[model samples]
Target: MTDRDAFVARLGGVFEHSPWVAERAYDRAAATGLTAGTVHSALCQAFRTALPREKMQVLRAHPDLAGKLAIAGKLTADSTAEQASAGLDRLTPEEHERFTALNDTYTKKFGFPFIIAVKGLTKGQILASFQSRIDNSPEEEFETACAQVEKIARLRLQSMIPGDENA
Candidate 1:
C-alpha cells in the first residue's frame, strides 16, 4: 500500500466510523510530515471543519459506553481496547445495570450516546461524567461529545505512530 493508504487503513477507526477524518489527515500529513502530533492536529482540523450534519454523524457513530455492542463483542477493536482499559469490560452485574440505565437516560436526553474518552479514567469517573453531562443542553452536549472524540483520536494516533511519545 502507498504511505497515505497505510496511514488511512491504520487510523481510520480513530474517530469510530469516520474514515474521512483519517483520509484528510493523511493528505495533510503528506504536505507536512507523518509525526503523531501533526496527524492528530490534522484529524482534529478535519473534524472541526466538517459540516454540521457530518459532525453529528461522527458523534452518532460512536457506540454507547458499556452498551449493547460491547456486550455483544461487536465494538470496533479500538473501542474494545479503550473500554477495556477503563475496566468497562469487567463490569459487575449491578455496574452493568447502572451503565445501561445511565446510557439510556443520556441518549434519550441528547439524542446521541454519551461519549467520554475512557482512557485513564475509572468506570466510576465515566459514570459520574455521564450523570453530569446528561443535564447539559443539546448544543453543549454535542460540543462536549466532539471534544471527547478528538481526545480519543489523539490518543489512538499517538499509539499507532512511533515517534513523539510525549504527544
Candidate 2:
C-alpha cells in the first residue's frame, strides 16, 4: 500500500466509523512527517474543525455503550475491545438493563450515544457519568460528547503510535 493508504488503514477507526478523519489527517500529515504527535494533532484538528453536521455524524457513529450492537456481536473490533476493557462486556442483567435504559434516554435527549473514553474507567464509573451527564443541557452535552470523542481518538492513536498523550 502507498504510505497514505497504509496510514489511513491503520488509523481509520480512531474516530469510530469515521475513516474520513484519518484521510483528512493524512492529507495534513503528508506535509509534515508522520509521527504519533503529528498524526494525532492532524486527526484531532480535522475532527475539531469539522462542520456541526459532520461532528454529529461522528458522535452518532458511536455505538451505545453496552447496548444492542455489543449484545449482537456487531461492535467494531476497537469498540468491542475498549468496552471489554471497562468491563462493559460482562455486565450483570440488571446492569445491562440499566445501560439499555440509559442508552435510550441519552440518545433521545442528545441525539447520540453517551460517549465516554472507556479505556481506564470501571463499569460503575461509566454508569455514574452517564447518569450525571443525562441532566446536562443539550448544548453542554454536545460539547462534552465531542470532547470525549477527541479523547477516545487520542487514546486510540497512543495505543498504536506510542507517544505523548498530549499530542
Candidate 3:
C-alpha cells in the first residue's frame, strides 16, 4: 500500500467506529509534513477538534465493558481483544449479571455507555469504576468518557504503528 493508504488502513481502528479521525490525521500529516514521531499526536488533535456531535458519536461507539456485544461475539476485533485482556471475557455468570446491570444503569443515567481503557485493568477494577462513575453528573461523565476514548485510541495507535514509544 501507499504510505497514505497504509496509514488510513492501520489508524482506522484507532477510534472505536470513527474512521474520520484517521482520515483527518492523514490530511493533517500531509499538510504539515508530520513525521511518524508526531502522527499519534496529530491523530489525537483530529479527535479533539471534531464537532461535539461527532465526539458524542465516537464515545457512544464504544461497547459497554462485558456487555451484550462481547457475549454475542459481535464486538470489533480490538474491543474483543481489549476486553479479553482485562478478563472481562472470562466473567462468571454472576459477574456478568452485575456488569449488565451496571451497564444498563450507566447508560440510562448518562445517555451513553460507560467507557474505560480496559487494557491494564482487571474486571474487578472495571466494575468498581463503573459503580463509582454512575453517580457522576452527566457533564462530568461526558468528559471522563472522552478522556477514556482518547486513551483507548492512543493504545490502539501504539499497537498499530511501529516504534511508537510515546504511545
Candidate 4:
C-alpha cells in the first residue's frame, strides 16, 4: 500500500466508531504527509469541507448537562463539562441548590449541554461561551456545535498513530 492506502486502513481503527471522521482523517493523510502540523491543518481543511452537514450527526456525542454517564468519559462532556461537574462536589449546600437551578435552566434553553472544545479554553472561557451560546437560535447553535465537532475531531486525529505509507 502507498501512504494513502495505509493511512485509510489504520485510521479506520482510530475512528471505527465514527465513519465520516475516519473518511475525513484518511483524506487528510493522503494529501499531506502525516506530521503534526499537517494533521492539524488537514483537520481544518477536511472538516470545513465535510462538517457543517455532518455536525448534527455527532451532536449526540456531547455529554449531558450534569456530566453523568458519558461515552468515552470526555466526548459527551468535554473537559470543562467535567470540571463544572466536579465543582459541584466542592459546593456548599446552598451553592449546590443554586447550581441545580442553573443547570436546569441551561438545559431547558439549550437542548444539549453547553459545549466548548476545552482543549485550549480556560474554565472561565468555557463558562462565557456557554452563557453566550445558550441564547443562540437552534440553527445557529447547530452550526456552532458542528464547528466544535470539527475542532474535536481534529484533536482526536492528532493522537492517532501516523498513517502508514504502505499497508
Candidate 1 global TM-score:
0.94
User: Tens digit of lDDT per residue, candidate 3, span 1-167?
Assistant: 88888777877778888888888889776676544446767788998898988889998899988988889999999999999999999889999999999999889888889999999998889988988999899999999999999888778766765676585
lDDT of 1 by residue, 1-167 (tens): 99878888888888889888888777787777878888888888888999999888998899998899999999999999999999999999999999999988888888788899999999999988988888899999999999999988888878888776665
Q: lDDT of all predictions, in order shown?
A: 0.88, 0.91, 0.85, 0.53
What is the Cα-based TM-score of model 2? 0.94
- Candidate 4 residue lDDT tens string, 1-167: 87656665555433213455556766666566666456556645555566544544455545543344432344322333444444532445564454455556666765555555556555446556666777788878877876776565555555554453221
Q: Would you estimate the TM-scores of all the predictions?
A: 0.94, 0.94, 0.91, 0.58
User: Comparing candidate 2 with candidate 4, which one achieves the higher lDDT?
Assistant: 2
Model 1 RMSD vs true structure: 1.2
Off by over 4 Å in 4: 1-17, 51-53, 70-112, 120-122, 156-167
* lDDT tens per residue, model 2, 55-92: 99999999999988999999998899999999999999
Instruction: Indicate whether candidate 3 or candidate 4 has the larger lDDT.
Output: 3
Q: Which segments of model 3 are wrong by more than 4 Å?
A: 1-3, 30-37
Best by lDDT: 2
**Candidate 3 TM-score, true structure as reference:** 0.91
Q: Give candidate 1 regions above 4 Å deviation.
A: none
User: Model 2, which residues run further than 4 Å from truth?
Assistant: 163-166
Give the candidates in order of lDDT, highest first: 2, 1, 3, 4
